[model samples]
Target: MNNSKNESVGCIVNECKFHSMGENYCTLNKIQVTKHETTAKDVQCTDCGSFVKR
Candidate 1:
């Protein structure tokens, strides 16, 4: 994965492969957001679908 950060996207998940190296940002131009439940009611119900384990 590219270590370069995408200014438009901010990410803090260090475990994710898309997370910018050494920064709270994303390397991809865009990311996919998914909901764990049929109707998301809070932040916990949502997830970054683009996340990949490093």
Candidate 2:
């Protein structure tokens, strides 16, 4: 597992396995980002495809 710190990659998903404890950051070296909508409209249309429920 690529358990590296990415200071710039902030995550608020506390239920995610990759979410750092007591912090707003992700421990994963990389994360898959995907579009939820058919057409690219706004930030809301995007989601973290790599989220794994803990």
Candidate 3:
């Protein structure tokens, strides 16, 4: 998680193991979004090849 507000806009699936869920709430970090999907943008996960829901 980033301390700077500007650096922490939201979570990104690339940083999370469970990003298939549309939940991006940052429980791990107060300022960060926990590295999960936060938008409808499509991202290709090479490890799982699963579509992330934003």
**For each candidate, what is the lDDT?**
0.89, 0.85, 0.35
Prediction 1 global C-alpha lDDT: 0.89
| Top-down lDDT ranking | 1, 2, 3
TM-score of 1: 0.86
Ranking by TM-score: 1, 2, 3
lDDT of 2 by residue, 1-54 (tens): 556656878998989988887788888888899997899699999999989998
Candidates 2 and 3 compared: the better one by lDDT is: 2
Best prediction by lDDT: 1
Q: Quote the lDDT for 26 in model 1.
A: 96
Instruction: Give the worst 10-residue stretch by lDDT in candidate 2.
Output: 1-10
Q: Which 10-residue window of candidate 3 scores lowest in summed lDDT?
A: 26-35
Q: Model 1 over residues 1-54: C-alpha lDDT tens digits?
A: 566999899988989888887879999887899999999999999999999998
Candidate 2's C-alpha lDDT? 0.85
